[model samples]
Target: MEKTVSAHHACVRTAFENTVPAAPPTSDDIWQTPPPAPAAGMLDVCGRERRLVTRTRERHTAVRQLPDSGSTLENVCRTLQLDRSTVRRFARATSIDELLVKATNRSTILGRYKPHLHQRWNEGCHTSAQLHQEIVALGFTGSLQTVRRYLRPFKAATVAPPARRPAPRPRRIVRWIMTDPGNLTADDAADLKEVRTSCPELDAVTHHVRDFAAMMLDLRGDQLPAWMERVLADDLPSLHSLINGLSRDIDAVTAGLSTPWSSGQVEGQVTRTKLLKRQGFGRANLDFLRKRVLLTP
Candidate 1:
């Protein structure tokens, strides 16, 4: 019975196999081809418009290309109907910090001149003429005035240029010691008072300087005219001696003071000097430091 059942199953399978036929290869089977066009109405996943990309050759054929060098300032101005100066200015703006760096660099050239000037001056070669000659040799065609100004500090050193190693510059030491104002406090006023009490002449000088300071400080707005009158009326001789003939420049001083401005600028500068001194950092010489602070800004 088992053999008869197996024979029957085999006969049925053979009959089913003979009814189905093998399929021929389609065109896609031979070519492995892509579709001719996208499927109808397919939307991009990102919801943005789908842009078709092209090969380099296709892109070149689609648009006109301009020559790279054709965008010069003159050409750009003509193309955009704009002024050439406007474009030039925009292109040439190098930044304030860049300008500052360049100026500082140029100023540092004078630093080189410092050592040479000192060396020459030490050997009794110190003269405006000699220094100017050396500067001229070094390509400084500016003027004798420039040379004079540059060499002035060396000549003013408290000690002559040393024949041995450079003197531990007292001026530089003073500057380094004095750059900060930490000690110039109420204590300074007390000390100054004590010194004034000990020396009669010193006391007189101190009082004069203080009065001058008070006069300058008091000159503000409507109070300025009254203040100036008081100062100018007091001991004209003493005023002359304190500020030289600058006391006679009364009108200019009054004008400067009357309009909310005073030698606050000058006093502020002196304060900066004392601060710099306390900080123990200035040029190697006090005179040099003085000139630097005055001339730098």
Candidate 2:
């Protein structure tokens, strides 16, 4: 009886052990909680990590801001700590037509028929589609009909009537002359005077130009000596600054006094640049023109 009872107890123990399977892993199973995954970072094309605190657009990222004191393109570029390429791009793109094309590109089509388009498209009979078809014949896979539709918007976008692109715009023709007060005609000067008077800084700049133009046009060699002596003796800061800037250019400035040549050679080069630019018909870039000019020389 004792043996049978002992055997029954051993069987019960074995049944209990068999009823329970091994438990799954709990907190004790892990060696350490894996460090939280590194916060997501931007990756470059090469798969290198680049962490930017905050993303900003390239175009909106200004090197510096101007006080809007009516500076020239060249001055604005320098003051703003910007590259000339960017400044020229911005300056030449003031017009809606110029700005619009960049926004919508039909430029690739226009390149082929450039100088001719200035004559033909300027005359107004040819449609953009017609032009596109012509280009298609030359192997452009782009939609031919879309050309006219693209160009149609430009007609309305021009700054002045019949394709006169004003500031920050590149029209089919008209080139930008300097915006300096010295560059203006008498009528334009008077108008700009009114404009300058409303802005004190601009007024100061205009007055400066007026003085410089007077000195350049009125003062003869003998007269210049007296005027320059007065400026030097007076210790005028503005005059000093002007002289300092122009001192390096003394040869160019005084060349007319000595020889029959003024900046006519330089002016001729500039005219050639403008003509070469006209070949680009407002589309040619400085590098392209430079290549042609440098290569020609």
Candidate 3:
């Protein structure tokens, strides 16, 4: 019994000694130090270096194709827009195939956390700000912008299509729908028909807009009162306000629509004045701007 108890105690002591906690890794041990430079004949090149190599190969081909002449080096330098020494070096290269090589981006600190990020993305944690916070807790030492750039493609791919099509701007849609039916394409007419069917309020507004446009184009001031009454009966707040303003100036509105004479010349002068003002911006005073507008033929 004494022998068995002694052996058990010895085993326990051995186990305890074997399980002693290891020292934590130092900062230097955690980070991998980069080599001074890539070794010669490495396949991986940066984008700029790869472009240079391609351009060099093309120039070399051009140089080799030229007929042998007294000034071959000078001719290559002038024609190919390359330096004398560069052309000579390319001439010596035995094979252009060796220039084509693979390009690899240098690894960043965030590389270690890429697997975790992808796993989180697959698990539905799509917000980069939130992911950045979570990875920071897991010992990531990269910026939020870096995380955002890396996840852009994944987010774009995962976005859901909108449930309903967005409506065009109110004025633009109104103009297109109210214009002469012959002026609109079949597709536009179909779209307008769809919109009118979906929204009864918009359908009412479309009818009012068409009536107003026809009255303006045909000079039918006699129909203005009935049009105003019909529009007032509708639920269009925007058109209601416009008709109310016209009601306050009914005589002027009716006369302008009925009479052949228009304020078009006055409007043209105003437009020309504004244009001249813009052209002489910063340098012209009000007097100079006025002179340019009035004096110019």
Candidate 4:
């Protein structure tokens, strides 16, 4: 049975990520409407980002062509076999580039060691081995080859760009939103607060998630209807998918949430049985597999 309380955090995260601007926006240019593409060859957008842009463009065009009488979020989700968040994102984006910024400009893990790499590079420490070892000692954990690859782009340059706020991945942002506020570090809390302030949609979703978390933690399945109603009142297409699924089997979902009974033990037993069966397949017979499954801890 589906849990009484579930969230479409991944869907919401993807939708939110599409809204991140490539460059820092001024107060007057929130997200820049259509952020200009980076200068060609200045930054390499990996193949995946290009493919994502193409796919999003297709969805965006499809949603735009939907007839007026059949263009509700639910209808779009059903017709396209996509989640609500995806439909909403595609329908609302001004351009495909809006969905491409994060993939192109997101912070890389090697970013932290840039200043060190640059200072050492300029000081004539051209030896990859020495440079790799030096940065490793300074808390760099990347492979030596990564250092070699990045150096190619800065081979002739005597400088690197100034550091900027590291863009946490969509999944990381979702985790920050889903986790209990009390469990987050001060830095994480502060960053999440800033993110919420910048994007009111995310802020609204966070509120819904916190409320859902509390209902689940307290085993308060009785409150699900109220929670769902509140969520529906907002433009939260991401969560609507979860609500739709739960509404189909509300009793079972409610019982699953309000009680501790679950299929966990049964699934564990099945998994162990498979492991024992595999272990005995070539080395022994069915009897051995059965004995192991039955007697082994």
Candidate 5:
């Protein structure tokens, strides 16, 4: 019987995940659920690589403290309250330095004029104001603060360009994907738009997610097969697995989408029964526990 059941019901990673309440979800409930959080692994726009490095170091340290950490990615994810993707990324990393490389290795607009900045600094132009003015005259449109921060790291370097890697861009991709567009911050909207424009694959994902959201909002379960077909047609391997999951119990999923029936009461009873069973450990026999659970008001 267990083998006959749909894995979608048991698997943490499935085609779609919802956190509906005990009752059938209303339109509001759909929106009120915790929005999908995207890659929860970006450093703030602070000027310190150390800040990001420290965070990556902490995650790596936590991973080491667990037994056979690679095989226990889910356990680590729960302990850290991190996204599964983030946790998987940590588990796959060869070392802290490797993870830090991804966190640190990024390009920025300020990259193009490094040579001029280095030349001026080496020629005794130590003042950021002068450097900023010079670079601005050379068509640099970035703020004077960019120049100052770039030069600040130089204070500790030995005349070479500081090994200071740029911080990864602030990614609310997952959050934006999971959240209603109406609820996004202006900055978040702009960032999401930019990300979609930059990566066609991510843009496709955004479109698919919004499509799924529409299906849910309108209870369009009949559209489920069509949606799966669309996903299958796409080049996204990640979503293909989800389509496979849905196919396992397409009829049930379709019914669920078309109707409001839910097993809330039965699920509640099961939860209560489990609670009672745990409480009765070493104190009551199975017969007594069963009677207590079934007879309790």
Candidate 6:
């Protein structure tokens, strides 16, 4: 009986040892193993570097095609709008292919933190500003622009489809409605038609706007009174207010519309003066600004 009990205890000990997990490697052990090199696809050239490479190759090809003259390098540089050093570098190269090989892409400031960015993106942190702040805490010294560019593709992939009945923005809708019907595309026209169906008042307003635009374009001031009456009769509070304001200066408005003589040139000068004032604000005094404006052709 004693031998049987010892055998059972030995079996239980063996089973428990096998079931228990081994201790994970310590930080010291992890530090001993060097990380594997990143794949080629993991690194990318920025837009400026890519452009530089492309320009170099193009210049090299152009240089090769030109005749071997003393002024050839100068002419190539002038034609390509490249610097003398850039042209000489390409000229010294053995071949166009050599120029390509010489174009090396420098690593970006955020290159080291790309893996962390991917991990955070996959875990659903999509806000670039938030990611920028988080990475800053993790010793990343790159600008928010760099982080934003890196996360563009990931953000695009994770974007939810727009809502079925997205509310129209007032300014955009007004711009669309105010644009000439001829200028609007078929899609825009169809969209406007849909919106009109949703709100009959908008449709009424659109017709009135078109009519008023036509009268102004044709200089038919005779039709202004009738148009104003029609607008006042409508329930469009905004148009009614506009008509009331116009009524205050109806004679001037009528004369300006009917006659070709206008303050357009004077208004243009006024706009220019205002722009000059803003440009020189706090930089130059009003007297200096006046002299500059008066002296300007």
Q: Which candidate would rank higher by TM-score, 2 or 6?
A: 6
- RMSD per model, one decimal: 44.9, 34.4, 32.9, 11.4, 15.2, 31.6
TM, every model: 0.22, 0.25, 0.41, 0.55, 0.48, 0.42
Model 1, stretches more than 4 Å misplaced?
1-183, 220-239, 261-297
Q: Indicate the TM-score of model 1.
A: 0.22
Judged by lDDT, which candidate is best?
A: 4
Give residue 217's lDDT in candidate 4 (0 to 100). Answer: 85
Over 4 Å off, model 2: 1-190, 221-244, 249-297
Error of 3 at 244 (Å): 1.3
Task: Quote the positional error of residue 31 for candidate 1 in Å.
Answer: 93
Candidate 3: residue 230 lDDT (0-100): 96
**What is the C-alpha local distance difference test score of each model?**
0.41, 0.41, 0.59, 0.63, 0.61, 0.60
What tens-digit string does per-residue lDDT give for candidate 4 at 30-116? Answer: 233432222211132221234544665677778877835567788878898988887787676545544543434444556655556
| Candidate 6 per-residue C-alpha lDDT over 145-210 given as tens digits, one digit per residue, 9 for 90 to 100 | 988886775544654221112222333346667899999977567656755655566666778889
Q: Which has the greatest TM-score? A: 4
Q: Considering TM-score, where higher is better, how would the candidates rank from best to worst?
A: 4, 5, 6, 3, 2, 1
Cα error, candidate 6, residue 56 (Å): 59
Residue 72 lDDT (model 5): 74
What tens-digit string does per-residue lDDT give for candidate 2 at 1-297?
111112122222223223322222123332243211111112321233332312212232332233245667678777767787876664543233222223322234333233333344556645676666655554445675545543554465332112111111112101111244445656445434433443343344334444454665653433444444545554234455666765677656555433444667899999887777788778877889889777765
TM-score winner, 3 or 6: 6
Please list the residue runs of candidate 3 whose C-alpha ends up more than 4 Å from where it truly belongs after superposition. Answer: 1-172, 277-291
